[model samples]
Target: MNPITLEGPRLTFRELREDDVDALFEIYGSEVATEHLSFDPRPLDSVASVIASGIADTQVDPRTVYALAVTLKEDPGLIGYARLALEAHRAGQIGFALNPSVWGQGYGTETVRLLLQLGFDQLGLHRIWGARSPKNAASARAMSGNGMVEEARIRDHVFTHGAWRDSITHVILEDEWRQPER
Candidate 1:
């Protein structure tokens, strides 16, 4: 399988590595970073396991999961985690989280754009979608900014943070994606 590596104007998406545990921990282990994610902040050991699993997933034939590291163009340190899981009928589900320190920057939108590019341009997928917590306006904006339309609200979608929570799904078709110039 080809290793996934994508470059945008401000960021790069690369295959996750075992050594990325500590860097990824900066996002996965932070309450603020995992606030809108389905799960709570992960422990350091959990981060290691997550990275390990991601590395193993890449080696699977006909790979269906892309769990990548988001890094700046000039720096090769992991600043965020991005995932795209392929499903049947030419569709994929995407999710992402960034370090809290980089929250306000345009990285989230760029990450979404890169994921769309990967699904449509690279993977030959027809539809790509992502779900975000209803209250996560930042995630909503990021997906929308990348041409993903808000499609549905699934009630009781996930039981997180001690209660059932709804999720807002945003989707884009391969034809509908407006690819950015390289």
Candidate 2:
């Protein structure tokens, strides 16, 4: 897990680099893209620090966070951010955000699958779950399409944009996951 990399048909999840600031800012700093995420649009200057932290997370003894840069196979540029944070009992929570330019395509689903692969396939995790804002229908569909069932609603789960928002969680157990057709 020192240097994470996961590839799919159209996308690749690789370790974040310091140079990814501008690309990541395109997604993290977009109001439309982060509308339902846990935080408001981030400042450009802050994105560098985020990348730095992700790079640092990789060097930890027992890595619990995989904050990856989602790049297309054809273009080796960061277009999205994908995260899988490990928890107790062999569980992990996934989260992702893509550049608004790629919203209509199916990359979101692929990103989720790649993260699942990293957790369940590579890390031997027992369960993987993701939480999305109640209003993010696209995220709901993406997670469900990957066999992650809508499990619960956490009240006041996050306080973002100056308000308490609830989150809908979707989960899939190791036994329930079927590897994507190779």
Candidate 3:
């Protein structure tokens, strides 16, 4: 599949490259930035590994995951990244992160909407889902903004930052997504 370029008012999404390793490491290495992610702050040794893994995963499982870089079209700075990953039974999961400086400006919502379109329209996915810790109000809002409905709250589903946090699952089905408003 060709790389995707998703645009919004303030951000653009494009496929990541090997050259992005340094920038990715800068953002992903920070404890504050990586706080809510499934993985902990990335290790120095894993920088190359991460980039390679993303590329390899996309090639080996095009239907499973596509990792993309998020940047400002004007300045072209690598601010963050996003991923659309196919889950079991043809469902998809969306995840992303942006530089702390860009939070609250609506980039996350826009990027996610584009991924949902790609998942449902282009990839023929049956459903798309997202999950986050309850404390991450901003993430929850972003997911809801893209038409995802709260499906369930998996209590103590994950251990992070020395605590067991509930994972709130949100999903939008293909039929539900076809509504006029969406």
The CA lDDT of each predicted structure is 0.91, 0.93, 0.82
Summed backbone clashes in each candidate are: 0, 0, 0
Best by lDDT: 2
Scanning candidate 1 in windows of ten residues, the lowest lDDT window is 173-182
Q: What are the root-mean-square deviations of the candidates from the true structure over C-alphas?
A: 1.7, 1.6, 1.8
Q: TM-score per candidate, in order?
A: 0.96, 0.96, 0.90
Name the runs in model 1 displaced over 4 angstroms. 178-182
> lDDT per residue, candidate 2, 1-182, as tens digits?
57887899999988999999999999989899989999999999888889999999998889998999999998879999999999999999999999999887999999999999999889999999999999999999999999999999999999998899999999999988964542
After aligning candidate 1 to the native by TM-score, how far in Å is the CA of 103 from where it should be?
A: 1.6
lDDT tens digits, residue span 61-177, model 1? 889999999999999999989999999999999999998888788999999999988998889999999999999999999999988999999999998878899999999987787
Candidate order by TM-score, decreasing, is 2, 1, 3
lDDT string for model 3 (1-182, tens) is 66677777777877778888878888788798878866678876686677787777766744477888889888666788888888888788898888787888888888778788778988889989988988778888989998898999999888777778889999999999999977
